[model samples]
Structure formats: structure tokens, C-alpha cells
Target: MSKFWSETVKRCVPYVPGEQLNDANIVKLNTNENPYPPSPKVVEAIKVEAERKLNLYPSPTVDQLRTDIAEYYGLSKDNIFVGNGSDEVLAFSFLAFFEAGKPIRFPAVSYSFYPVYCKLFNISYEEVKLNRDFTLPVEAFFQTDGGVIFPNPNAPTSIYLEIDAIKEIVENNPDQVVIIDEAYIDFASESAVSLINTYNNLLVIQTMSKSRSLAGLRIGFALGNSDLIEGLTRIKDSFNSYTLDRLAIAGAEAAIKDTNYYKSTTREIIHTREWITAEMKKRGFHILPSQANFIFVSHYNKQAEELYAALKDRNVLIRHFNKPGIDNYLRVTIGTNKNMELFLNKLDEILA
Candidate 1:
């Protein structure tokens, strides 16, 4: 309520990120972070880069890292754009593509950050409701006034929409930009990145924080038609030239190049997710069919808030959204097998 606050600053309702407790003993499953450490190659690359270039500014164009990501995704460096994280990339997209009066469209229960970004940018938006089963209504996103954006396997729900469905949405909205945030696509069945070569209006943004076990390293990128890449580049250049540091560029390049380690760790997380789903269902939780590394679920009898508090008391943390219609559901990241076992044991004690 101070005169120092601008109208924009006063209007801002910032996104509340998952709790980052400092307790080393806490089993954190709230944020969908990889339980494993970043690949040894990523660490080595960072160490090498850190020793050589802490004083010099990073590449504003981020040429080599963009090249590495493009090579991995079978695209050209011109088709890629890198930023601090997908959140920043998304923020730039909202400014670059979506307009103030012309409202954009996203799922009513999709990633919470989408609405926050819309508010911050003063872009009007419509939240098209998902189907009762939590699947995206592809037609609802068609012919949007401004543009469209949503996570593929939507956040908190963890239900994946197929690429064919995605293609349909893109095809339907020929004039509008369709941004697909694929932060969890590595753990999923497939990626919409395959469709970008054919659809000029599609932009697929991804992060290294989840599947690559580099949450501590703030790196995210986008792949699309070279034009969209240029648009994001314009927005980025207008603000800051170097969104990625030297160490981040090197580590991200290494993470992109280390495909084998990424595959093994992603496979393990999928396996853990499968077993955890079964275990939770056996204990009366209604689980979504998750292709991502986390599970969205609700207990048959227990309240989500109560369960969340009980788990926190046991030193195990999971996410519980306080929003309407999903206040009873919790989103749990799939951890190591031993971690899941310990979580299950803690839950049994609470439920018993």
C-alpha cells in the first residue's frame, strides 16, 4: 500500500513455488524435481567452465548450447531459444505473442503459472475447462483470440494428451501460437517436438530441471519454427542479453549431450511411479494415469490437507493445492524406490 509501488507491482500476485526446506533429512516430494543428481558429465562440464570463465559474460546468443539442444532434438539451432528457465521463456512468449485485449486460452485446471503470467502481462485469458476425466478438450483451444498454451501432460493432473491430439489443436488454431510446455516429456511416452517441423505455429518449451536432474541449474529452452524462435529472441534481447551464465550454458550442453544417463534415470522414475500408483490405489487413492515423473491423486476417505500435514509432520513433503475443485487432490513426485517405501510406511502409520 505504499506510493512507491507501481500499478503493475501492486497487481502482481506472485507464484508460490514449492517449499524448499533446508532440512537435509526431509524427504521432499512436493516439487517434481528429479531425485537423482545431475549426470557426472554435466558436473564435469560445469567445473571446467567455472574454472575458465567466471569473469566473461556468457554468450547472448547461446550458440553452442542451442546447437547441442537442437542436435539432440533433430532440429537446427535457428529453431531453438534458450532462457533462464521455462518460466522465463513462457513469460517472454506471453509478451511476444499474446496481446492485451485479445484473450488467450488455456485449461481451467492446468499449470497455475499460466494465469499468473497472464495477470503479470495484463493479457486477458479464458480457461477452457478440462473434461471430467481431466483430459484436455482439444477443440476448446481452437481459434483462440490471442493464442494458446498448456503443458502436454498437464501439471497437478499428470494426464498426457497424445501428439495427434496436439496436432489437431495446432491445426485448428492455424493463426494462433500454440505453446506446449514439455518439462516432463522425457519421462512421458512421446514429445510434441516431432510436430514442430510441420507446424509453423507451434512452440515447444522444455526444462532441464526435471528429467535431467538439474533443478539447481536454471536452464530451459524452446523449439519451434525459426520465426517463433526469433520472436522469443527479440523479447529476450529487449530485456537481458545473457539469460544463461557460462556455467549454466556448459552444464546444459553436457546434460543435453548425455542421452544415456538421462534415459536410465527417466526409466527408473517411470518404474517407481508405476509401483507407487499401485501401492496408493491399494490403500484407496484415486490415481491419474501419469506419463510424467509425478502422480496426481486423491484419497478415497482421507482429506488431502490432513494427509499433507501428517506427511510434513513425518518429515516427508508432498504438494497439496488449495484451489477449488482440486483441493482434495495432491501431486506427489516419484522419488527413489527406498524413498517411496519410506513414504508409504509413514502414510501407513498416519492412516492406521
Candidate 2:
């Protein structure tokens, strides 16, 4: 507790992202980053923008990019909100909608970021427990003191709750906002984006980092009713009117518009996730039912930390959370075929 530390800093419990080891030889499956590169269009768009507009500031409203994203999702620009990344969008959402006195609700085992955001914003919250099987208990999220926010697939567990269940939560919380963090939805079966037009309180947040393979570009967006979008926009403009720079805006625009590239990459990741799930099961790991570009699993006999440590020693890294209830599990990102083959081979060696 330094004297210089503000109350916010003192209360904040920061989120620990996946380890980013710089070893070229490592097979990284800890972070759920796409195993592919951004589309050629994304590359070309970024280059063109860089040459033409390095001297000019990016559009604060981000109109063209928002319009492009809306067209892709069959919504209007007014229904969209773009930020530096989904993390920023989420931060703005907490400040814009959730109040400090009214505690919001989210799954206990959900995105690690939710609690951190709650702490940073000084917003009170309740951690709704997930089912024993790691699925979200929709009934428990109903009629919250504040609003509701949770990942669609409920991170680390990677168990997707259907939209019908999501609708019930939204309908029940009619007076408050219900934010769905769909960072992994592109890899999943469906998105709750369809519910935005139907529910004024629904906000579906997504990122171009994963499926779009632009993790370096730092782009994320939110889809919601125009009012919710406006609220987020007000918060964003208050903080940084130009949250996304010119390069990021151009790259994100191309990423959103190139539907064909996203489809092919997304399909490949899904295929890889399925194959890896089956293989892990055969190896005696209890794999969770994942609809994302990653799989959550636990070896029947191996400790998660021990496996994690052993893999890191061999330059094959995956994620292991130390928090209870999920301390035994590991989250493995679906890499390219060759990368997965290497990961499996390394696992075999470690098991042997």
C-alpha cells in the first residue's frame, strides 16, 4: 500500500493473462489465439492506410468501421460500438451501466476478467456458482441486484450455454443490462447477437483478436440496442474519443468484411478442436464439451500443474488455473494441425 496508490489501485485485483513466452520452439496453446494469420485483405488494408494517413488522427466516431461491422451482422452503425479491444469495451460497459452500489452477477468460474473489472470500477458483484459439470446455471442469474455479464461459453470450462438459456436471463433482467462476452463465439455454434434487436438490455461483445487473427491489431466491438450502444459510446468518448488508431481501424474493417477468410479459418479451428477433444479423451483426459477454439480437459491421473510444468519444460505450453474448482483442469488452445500433432506427441512423451 504505497501512499501514491489511489483507492482504485489499492482495491484492484488485476487479471493475469496467459503466459507469453518468447521461445520460438515452444508450442503455445495457453492463450486461445488463432493458429492462423489475418486475411490478405487485412494485410493490404493496413498497409494502404499506413502509407496514406500516418499523419492524420483516426476518426473518433469510427463510423466507417462501425458501418462495415454492422453490415456484416445485419445491424446499423448506431447499434455498434468499437473500442481498442473487447477489454476496453467491457471496462466501459462496467462504468456505463453497472453501478457501484448495486452488485452485478456473473458465473464464479467465468472469465477471470469480470471480477477484475468489477474490482477496478468498484462495482459490487455476486459470483453465481456454475453447475458441478462447469455449465452455467441460468436460473441462478435471474433478477440480479445490478446487471449481469458472463462469457457465452463460460471460459476455462468452455461449456456453451444455449441462446434460449441466455434469453431467459435477459428477459428476467429486463430492467438491467445483460452483457454477453462472445470473444469465442465465432468458433462456437451460434451467437447471442440475434437477441440484441429483441432485447434493449442485451449487449453482445466480441473481438477481432481470435478468429480474425488480428491479436496484434487490438480491435473489439459491442453489439446492442441503439441506447446501450449510445451509453457505451458516451463512456468511450469521455475517456478516449479516438480509442482505435487508423491502422487498427483499417485492419479491423477488412477483418470484418472478409467473411470468406473468417469462415475458412473458423472452420479449420473447429475441426482441430474436435480432433483434439477425441484424442485427449482417448488419452484418459476428461475433456469438456467445447464450442470454442479451445478445449478444457483434465487427465484422470495427472495433476494440472504438474502437466503444465512438464509441458513448459519441454516447450509445449498450455493453461492451468490455480484457483479452486478449476485447479485440476487445463485449457488447451487449438493450434494448427502440425502444432497439435507436436503437442500430442509431447504429451505422449510426458505420459510415457
The number of residue pairs in model 1 that clash at the backbone is 0
Per-residue lDDT tens digits for candidate 2, residues 58-80, read 89999999999999999999999
- RMSD, one per candidate, in order: 0.7, 0.8
Best by lDDT: 1
The collision pairs in model 1 are none
lDDT string for model 1 (172-243, tens) is 889999999999998888899999889999999999999999989999899999999999999999999989
- Candidate 2 Cα outliers beyond 4 Å, as residue runs: none
Q: What is the C-alpha lDDT of each candidate?
A: 0.93, 0.92
